[model samples]
Target chain A: MNEHTPTPTEALPGAGNGLPSYLEQSPAVRERFAQLQQRKVILEVRDLQKRYKSLQGETEALRNINFQVHRREFVCVIGPSGCGKSTLIRILAGLEKHTAGDVLLDGQPVTGPGRDRGMVFQGYSLFPWLTVKRNVMFGPLMNGHSRDSAEREARLWLDMVNLGKFADAYPHQLSGGMRQRVAIARALVNEPRILLMDEPFGALDAQTRAKMQRHLLKIWRNLDITVLFITHDLDEAIYLADRILVLKANPGEVQEVIEVPVPRPRSPEQFSTPEFRATKARLEALIHPPEAQGEEEAEGEDALPEKIIRFTNVGDNVE
Target chain B: MNIRILLTYLSRPSRYRGAVFTLGAFLLPVLLWCAVSYVPFIWHPMVKVENPGGVDYFTPGMLVDRSEFQDQMKEMRQAGKPLPVGVRANPIYLPAPHEVARALYTAFTTAPEQRDAPWLHQSLWHSIQVIFWGFVLSSVVGVPLGVLCGTYVTLSRLSEPFVEFFRYLPAPAFGALAVAVLGIYDGPKIAIIFIGTFFQQVLVIANTTRKLDTTILEAARTLGTRGWRLITHVVVPGILPDLYRDQRILLGWAWTYLIVAELIGTSSGITWFITQQARYQHFENVYAAIIIIGVIGFGSDLLFERIGRRLFPWDRTQERKSA
Candidate 1:
C-alpha cells in the first residue's frame, strides 16, 4: 500500500504526490488541498439529540450525533423516511429544536431562522400572489437591497434556471417542475453560501426529478458553495453527492460515508457502469447489513475481485 | 323594448345558462302579470245564473256589464274622459296589474315619495350611505383585530368562544340590544347594522388566517419574513382571496341588517316609509320599497362581483368552480 495527499477537489480522486510519497509539485497545491481538507468549520454538530415522548411511548428522533461540514462541499445526509432524516433537517433549518447538543454554524450557534442559509422544501413554496421576479427578489429586498438591484439579481438567477421568460408569471401558472425551478432561483438569489434543501425534489414526478437532479448538479457544481441536502432516495444519494452520509432508523447517526467515484459532469449513463455498481453495492451492504449472517459478507468481499476485473474490461470509456 | 332585449339574449351562445334560471325566475312573473292584464285573447264567464232556488249563484263583484251606472254617465260628461260603452269585468283584486305597475312606476320615477321618504330623499342614496358606514366600520375594526387574533394562538384561543357565540346571534336581536343601549335614535339603528355584520366579518377574517397554507408560513420564515412584515407580505396576501369574498358577503349582511334597523321606528328609512305607507293602506308604496331593496342589494352585489373578478383574476376559477 502507498500513501497519497488529498486533492483540492472532493469528488475527484487524488492524482499527484509521486516524490517519496510526501512531496507534491508545489507548496501552493499542497496548501490548497490542506485548505480544502481544513475545517472552515461552516457547521459543527456535537452530540445532537432529540426525543419525542407520547402516550404511545418515548421515541428518539436523534441520538448523540457528531459531524462537521467544511466550506463548499456537497454534504448529503441520506436516510430512510422515518429515520429522523426530516427531524434532523428541520433542526438544521431552524424549524424544530433538538432535546440536547449544540449545532454551531460559522462559529455561532443557530438560535432561530436566519438568511445565512437559504432553504427550499420539497413543496415549491412560492408565494402565489407574487410573480417569479418578486418571489425571487423577496430575500434580497428584505436584506436591504434596493428594489432595482434586487430585481436585477432576480432576473439573473431566473435566467440561470432558464426561467427568465416566466419571470412575470405567478406561481400557480407554473407546473410543479417550473415552480421548483423558481424556488431554486429564489433561494439562490439571496446569495447564501450554504443551500439547505430538504428533499426539494421529493414532490416532483420521477422524470421531472431526474431533470431537476441534473439541473441541480450543474447549478451546484458551478457555484462555489456547500449544499446540505436531505433525501430518502438511495439512487439520488449516489447520483448528486460528493460523499454520502447514511442515517439508520429510530435514532439517526452517521452510519456510513460512501464516496461516489464518478467523474465530474456526471451523466446518467455513467451510473450503469461497474464502478458505480460497486460503490452502490457497498452502500446497500451498509444500509441492509446481511441480517446477522457473517458468512455473506465473507463471500461478498471474495467475489468483488471478479467485479473489478469486469469493471476494467466492460466499463472503460465505453461511452 | 324588453321584447327586443329578450330576443337578443336568447340568440346568443351560452344563453341557456342565463335562461335556465335568472331570466325565468325574474321575468316570468312579469310576463304572466302582463298577459293576464293586457293580452286580449281569451274570455271567460265571471258569473253564472240558474233558476230561482235551483242552485242559483250570484258573485257580488263579478258583474260583467255595469256600463249604465251613474259614475260612468258622469265620466262621459267629463271633457277628456271616455264613457264605458261595452261590457267590462273588474279584476278579482279590483285594481288590474297594469294599473298597479303604472302607479308603481309613477310613484318611483316622478314623485319618488314612496322610495325617497323611507330611506332618505332617495332610496339608492340612503342605502348607499348606510352600507358605506357599515362597511367602513367593519373593515376598520374587524380586519386588524381579525389579523391579530388569527395569527396569535393565545389571543385566538382566549377570544374564539366569545366571537363564535356572537357571530351566530341573530342580527335583529342585536338591533334590539342596540335600541336598549343607544336609544331609539338613528345612531342606535345604524349601530345595529354595524354590530350585525361585525361578528361575521371577524369570523371570516380569522378563518382565512387559520386556513393559510402552512407551506407559505414556513417559506416566509426561511426568507426572514417574521413579525409584522410577515403578516403584511405573506399572511395577508395568503388570506386576501377569502377576505375579499367575505367583504362582499359582509356588505350583503349589512344591507339586510339596515332594513331591519330601519323598521325599528316609524320615523325614517325605506322600511319605516314602507311600514307607514302600509299603515295608510298604500300597497303601491310597499311594492316600491320591496323593488328598491332588491335593486340596491342586487346593485351592490353586482359591483362587488365585478370588482372582485377584475382585481383578483386568480379567484375567478374558484368562483366558477363554486358556481
Candidate 2:
C-alpha cells in the first residue's frame, strides 16, 4: 500500500493524506509524518440512541452507540433488519433527529439537514420530475452556486458514473441500475465531507448489485471521501469496507467491530480467499451463533466449519 | 368525403378504434333525436275514442296531424270549452335534429337583434368570461393558501372545518346574497362561480401538496433547501402535475355552475338566452342554444386536456391508460 502512494508530481493538493509528499528530503518527510500522525477524525458519534413512541407502546431502536470515522475511511455497518441501521444513517444524514446523543461533523453539531453530508438511498430517490442533469445539479444550485458552474459539476459527475448521455432523461426513463448511478452522482455533486448510504444497492438485482459494488469502490477510492454505508448484506460489508460494524437486533447495540486485514483494491475473486472466509465466518457466528445451544456446542467448534461451508456456498453464487 | 379511404383507414389501421368511437359518441345522440322525431310517421294511434254521444265518430287508423290538433286546441280555447283529454300529444314537442340545427344557424346569422343582445356566440363569450375570471380568482386564492395549509398542519386543521362546512352549503344558495353584496352586472355571477369552486379547490390542492413524496422532499432538504425555497423548488414542482389534473376537473365543475350562476339577476349568458327563447315558445332556439353550450364545454375540455399534456408530459398516469 505504501509503495502505491502518490509521487510528488502526482500528489493532489489537499488530498486525504494530510502528510506532505514523502518524495521530499528525508528530514522534511519525518517532519511531515510527525504532523500527519494526528489524522483528522471526520465524524464523531457519542452515546447515540433512538426511541420510538406510538399509541401502542414505546420501542427502543438504538442504544448507546458510539463510533468515529476518520477521513477517507469506508466504514460499513452490517446488521439484521430492524437493527436500527437505517435509523442510524438517517440521523447522520440529518434527516432524522436522535433521541439523545451528540453527532459532530468536523466538531459542529448536526442540527438538521445540511450540505455537509450527502446521502443515497436504496429507493433511488431522485426527483422524478427533474432531468438527470437537474437532479445532480440541485444541491449546488440551491446552495447559491452559479448555474453554469453547477451544471459543469453535474456533467463531471455524470461522466464519472458513465451516464453523461442521460443528462436530459427523466428518472422513470432510466433502468434501475442507471437510476442508482444518477443517485450516486447526485449525492457526490454536493461535495460533502462524508457520504451516507442506506442500503444503496439493496433494491438492485444481483448482477447490478455486484457491478454497483465495484463501481462504488472505484468512485470511493478516486474521491477519497469518508463513507458510512449501512447494509444488511454481510457479503457487501466484507467486500467493500475498511472496518465492519456488526450490530445485534432487539434494540440494536454494537456487537463487534471487525477490521478486515485483506489488502486494498479488493477484487471479486477475493471473496473465496481464506482470509476473507475467516473474517466472514467470525461475523456469521456473531450474527447467528451455534453456541446459543449448549448441546450443539458439544461437537466443539462445530459452528465454525458449518458456517464456513455455508459462506463458500453463498460466495459461489455471486457471479 | 372519401368513403373508401375512410373505410380503408378504419379497417386497416391498428389504432383507429378511438377515432371511430369518438365519431360514434358525437353522432349517436343526434341520430337518436332524429329517430324520436319520426314517431308521427310511425303513428297508429294507441288510444281509441268511443264517441259517447255520437259527435263526429273518431277511429284509430286516422293520422292525427299536429297542426290540426293545435288548431282544435286553439278553437276550444276561443269557444270557452274545456280542452279535450285522452288525445295523444304532438311529436313536435321534441323538435327534430334538423330543426335544431336550422335554428342554430338562424340565431347566429339571421336575427337582427342577435348582433347586439344575446346572439349565440355573444352569450357563449359572456359565459366563458365569467367562468374564466371566477376560475382565475379561485385559483389565485386557493393554490397558495392550500400550499400553506398543506405545509402547516395547524393551518390545515383550522381551515378544515370551515372548508368542509361551506362545501356542503350549495353555491347557488348564496346567489341572492351574492347579488346583494356584489350586485347584478357581472359581480354576482363571477362570485357564484367562485363560491362554487374555491372551497373544493383548496381541499384538493392541499391534499395534493401534502401527498408529495416525503423522500423527495427530504432529499431536497438535505441539499440545503428550506422554507420558501423548499416550496418553490421542490414542493411546487412536485405537485404541479397533480394540481394540473385537479384543476382540469375543477374547471369542468366551474362550467357546471355557470348556468346556475347566470340564471340569477342577469340575462347575459347562454342559459339566459335559452330562457329568453323558451318564453316565446321557440323550442328549436332553446335546443340550439343548449347544443352550443355543450359544444363549447366539450371544446374547453379538449383544450384543457391539450394544455395539460403539453405542460406536463411526464404525467402518464391517466392519459396512458386510455392511450
User: What are the lDDT scores of the predictions, listed in order?
Assistant: 0.71, 0.79
Model 2 residue B76 lDDT? 68
Candidate 2 deviant stretches above 4 angstroms: A1-38, A290-319, B1-15, B39-90, B112-116
lDDT of 1 by residue, A10-65 (tens): 22222232111112223553454456566586877888999989798998888877
Off by over 4 Å in 1: A1-36, A53-57, A285-319, B1-104, B110-121, B174-177, B280-285, B316-323
After TM-score superposition, the amount by which residue B317's alpha carbon in candidate 1 deviates from its true location, in angstroms, is: 4.4
Best by DockQ: 2
Per-candidate DockQ vs. reference? 0.26, 0.31
lDDT (Cα, tens digit) per residue for candidate 2, span B1-323: 35436634655553477678889998898777666565544442332232212223334333355555456557767877655433442344466678888998997875634456656777778899999999999999998988888878999999978998999989999999998998888999999899999999999999999998888888888888888999999988888888888888999899999999998776577887888788877889888888888788888788987787678755657445444
lDDT per residue, candidate 1, B124-205, as tens digits? Answer: 4665676687678878999888877888989888887898898777867766667777777676667777778788777788
Enumerate residue pairs that collide in model 1: B118-B269, B118-B270, B119-B269, B119-B270
Best by lDDT: 2
Error of 2 at A211 (Å): 1.2
**Residue range with the least summed lDDT across 10 consecutive positions in model 2 chain A:** A13-22
